[model samples]
Target: MLRGLIASGRLLANRATTQPARLSRNLVTAAGPTSRCSLPHTHHHHPVAAVPALARGMKVRSSVKTMCDGCAVVKRKGRVYVICSKNAKHKQRQG
Candidate 1:
């Protein structure tokens, strides 16, 4: 009796798993083979030459290599921007 119960339980579990697959198949047929909502019909065509002009021939500045000197904030004409280790850590914590 215990073995029979275990077999029935497994059969029920298998049927439940198969139910979702059958439901998906029926939904696909009803929607039509070409009109699947999960898959996008129209794909956006992106430009092959999507590279920025600056990236083509950009010279790296030595100052920009170690930008802000590991400090959280820097004042260049009194305009503040997040550019350091502490600032990044602080931003992540805030988020």
Candidate 2:
């Protein structure tokens, strides 16, 4: 039941991002209507931080709120593990 809920939530999130995806597509099309251009040319600074930050916050909040399998494993280690783009995993594993 919990897994179903989680899966449903993921699906909803994926659906929600469709707008941004479409917007990006439109931006690409508009940038070069006649020719194929690279995506980096379309980059524009937004008022707020980029989408990656928002996604990170959502992931952190969800992980903190729910005691899911990965969180449980982290809890057993007596330390909190946060996912960051720079450092994927916080600590190095010892054999």
TM-score of 2: 0.27
- Per-model clash counts, in order, read 0, 0
Top-scoring candidate (lDDT): 1
Clashing pairs in 1: none
Q: Which consecutive 10 residues in model 2 have the weakest lDDT in total? A: 86-95
State TM-scores per candidate. Answer: 0.35, 0.27
Tens digits of per-residue lDDT for model 2, 1-95? 99999999999999898979998789777876677765566677769856564322223333342233232223436544443334333322212
Note the Cα lDDT for every prediction shown. 0.56, 0.53
